[model samples]
Target: MDWDDMRVFLALARVASLGRAGQVLKMDPATVGRRVSRLEGHLGRRLFHRSHQGYALTEDGLRLLPHVEAAQAHLSAAETPNDTGAGLSGQIRLGAPDGCANYLLPQVIARICADHPALEVQIVALPRLFNLSRREADMAISVSAPQAGRLHVQKITDYHLHFAAAASYLDRHPPIRQIADLRGHSLIGYIPDMIFDKELDYLANLDLHAARMTSNSVPVQLNLLRQGTGLGVVHDFALPHAQDLRRVLVPVFSLTRAFHLVRHADDLRNARLRRFAEALIVGLRDQVARLEQAVAQADDQANSENP
Candidate 1:
């Protein structure tokens, strides 16, 4: 089997579309389809089930994938020299919850790409968990690590959050001496059913419910806070973007969560992915530490001035 054909097959399997695979390979769609056809003829197994939903992988294809992925990993490793002089080149897609994607990954990825000009990074920020098994993304940052699956997980960093609101909203509202006062304010937070992970259920820790304003996206929630719509749990790292927002019940309420770096098991053998993962882990730790410190210092300054 031609290695080039195997690449086309993998690309088609991943994206589930001829045009998308072709674009990734910089080849014509017809050429991509032809390559898949040739590979099927060579292997004597129909790899994909073609339909309106695009090319869904067949049972045979599913069985063949891990072997092919292993082979590809080996090939990629062999291509890397002992000195590793070449700049990291290739696309690395990361699936993350919007909080990290919006507040953290941009700056971290910026530095990564700056150091390696050839590298390309794509961040998919969604409220739901990513299916890394299906190659939804090469890597994922999750609130909690998974216990099952042929995968690798690493704890990136633990970050903090607090019940926070814009200064304008705070000034206009009744003083919040304790959690009980929250009942009088418009609570902005995730839609109850839309909380994808147990860790994302921020209000539950405080025995609170019924957010008058809700969204699945973190940025949307943050925007609601920025607009003085209401006070809600906000990540400390996200505070830089909304400097006007201030923590409420800081002495009484706080949430700590960690970000986990997850990747496919087979990626352990791929030198390029390993390098990218290392850089990503380091960058995330640094960014979280740096952002949290800045927030703490600002909080201190605010309190000192008021006192």
Candidate 2:
């Protein structure tokens, strides 16, 4: 039994898709498929049931899983000492929401890379959850903490969001005096149906009938807000770049969401992964004050009245 073949098998089993497993392995889908087939031939047993959706483990595959996992753990343990001395030299796939990836993580990741040049960090920015159990990401920055999983979870930071719009739009439109006044104006937000996480369902808490413009991407929503399209929930960290935008209903309409750091239990034991996790925590902690700052200036007229 080839260890490399087992590694491919584990990646496929965890990700359940050839493309994604290939991504983890830095191989093409065709290569991953071939490798899996080769491994099955070597084993003389069918390991996976292939479908359009993804590959699922056969009964035999399930039976083989624990033994393979134990072997993997032993191999990882044996390599840890060499890795610690060699410096951080492996890839880490980090999954995060667009808001964090675009606005916050790049700087942190860049710094980490600069300090440890051999390390490679792949950022997967999407609206949906990353399954740590499946190794979708080595580490994930999630909106909410995981309730159940063989994972290590920690609160990274509490970031704030506010109702914001381009100054030009607010100036041209009727004043938003109260929550009810929102109905009379055009609003921008996430498409309700496209919201993957319950924590991302910002519109549900508001007195909103429909959004004037909707997008799954936070950057898109912010762009529309900057274009003077309509008011929408904007993260404070993103406010610094869009000079024309201003937060409306600050303090009152502001929302706080916690970013949690999550990693699979097995990966947590890896020296490289532990170091990356520490770097992420330190990076996020450094941004605490900036992320928590009020989006609007104190003297702004929008801050004076309740709307």
- All models: lDDT? 0.89, 0.81
TM-score of 2: 0.82
**Tens-digit lDDT string for candidate 1 (1-307):** 8999999888887778998888789999999999999999999999999998889888998888777888999888788846275688877789999999999999999999999999988899998899876777888999999999899999999999998999999999888979988886889999999889999888875656589999998999999999988889999999998899999898988889999999999888888988999999999999999999999999899989997
TM-score of each: 0.95, 0.82
Off by over 4 Å in 2: 11-35, 48-70, 81-86, 174-177, 291-307
Best by lDDT: 1
What residue runs in model 1 are displaced by over 4 Å at the alpha carbon? 51-53, 81-85
lDDT of 2 at 83: 56
Which 10 residues in a row give candidate 1 its minimum summed lDDT?
A: 77-86
What would the per-residue lDDT of candidate 2 be over residues 45-79, giving only the tens digit for each residue?
Answer: 99999998889888998777656766876777777
